[model samples]
Target: MDARFLGIPELAEAPSVAVVIDVMRAYTVAAWAFAQGAEKIVLAESLDDALALKARHPDWVALKDGPPAPGFDAVNSPGLLRSVDLGGRTVVQKTTAGTVGALAVKEASLVLCAGFVVAEATARILRSRGCDSVTFVVTGEDGRADEDLACAQYIARRTTETTTDATGFLRRAGASRAATELTEGVRRGAHPDDVALCLELDRFRFAMVATLEDELMVLRPHDVPSPTGTAAA
Candidate 1:
């Protein structure tokens, strides 16, 4: 098997099995929502589309990354989602990088949204597929967001049965500019726990898989079995 690490710019030409990683917050929020028992999540291309979807389905929970919008339930903050009872409800998500990266990959046969919160499960799912090639789309722009790239490295190493330096990766991730900025946001009264929650590794045990349905990028959890071929406890 071959694994190649790329960024958002290379997403369109990604190989058959691809994992779109957004460790700063997006996919981490999705993981928490699923852990809270959300039925499914729709990855909206834009905030406008997310609002429209919320309008169409009043029962669906609309989530975004910006200031409050009309009819939106909440922002994409995993720390905030812990209090909500999301059981059996649909979630419509909009974010600048994560959702865009998930939708931009047109050639991948399989697409999965990932973060450090679900990194181990992401690797488990990829390994079980037995695919020839896998592409890790670190959804950060240019050389920014080193945390996402570190996550890709960890998942890649895990999926290929190679040794990974989790501690070193975590150190690199914590010192990144993205981490610093988000931490600054916390001091300004944003979701204070978001940065901490997002950095927690392997917090969830399921992989969030995305599939295009009626032009919507729908995300649902795919449970990854243990190396012993049974459900992870």
Candidate 2:
């Protein structure tokens, strides 16, 4: 299978299988929420949207938001997600990157969620389903490039099947700038612990993919048919 990079527009136009990557934290938090036994996930494109979902499903989910600014619940930090009780509940998540990316790929045939936390599982799910083509849609705070590309590289590494040459996109996108900024921020006493956590790969076994139910979009684990010729549905 060949890997492709698609901006939101292209993603909206073609509509094929896609893996949304938001590793800096939205999907990472989703992974955490699932680990905490969240029954379902709703990835909203905006904070207002997420809040509205929370308003409707108050008992089932917690509202989590993360904007690009500091000191806002709209920020994407895994540690913040752990501090809450999401046990057997759902999360109406609105992150700057993840949700937007998810929304962008709404036109895709299969919009399976992907991130560093479940990179390997995601790859297995994709391969098991025999995804011959993939579009790595990177959503950002304001549609920025860095974090998503980092995640794309992670997914690309696993998608390659043999070697982990994930550096192509990173190098092409000049990931060093963000690397520097991240390191400097850590040196300046900003979220050093989180910086470490974000870089770790495959620390989970879950896979969250979007599915349609009564004309609504939602996330669920990749429990579909396996590529080993076994029925999973």
Stretches > 4 Å off in candidate 1: 12-14, 186-189
Candidate 1 clashing pairs, residues 3+ apart or interchain: none
Regions of candidate 2 where Cα sits further than 4 Å from its true position? 12-14, 67-75, 141-144, 163-192, 223-233
RMSD of 2: 4.6
Error of 1 at 110 (Å): 0.7
> In model 2, what lDDT does residue 17 have?
82
Clashes of each: 0, 6
lDDT of 1 at 153: 84
Which ten-residue region of model 1 has the weakest summed lDDT? 185-194
Candidate 2 lDDT tens digits, 157-230: 67655456545544433344434555466322234455445555667766788876655568876543445655
Error of 2 at 14 (Å): 4.2
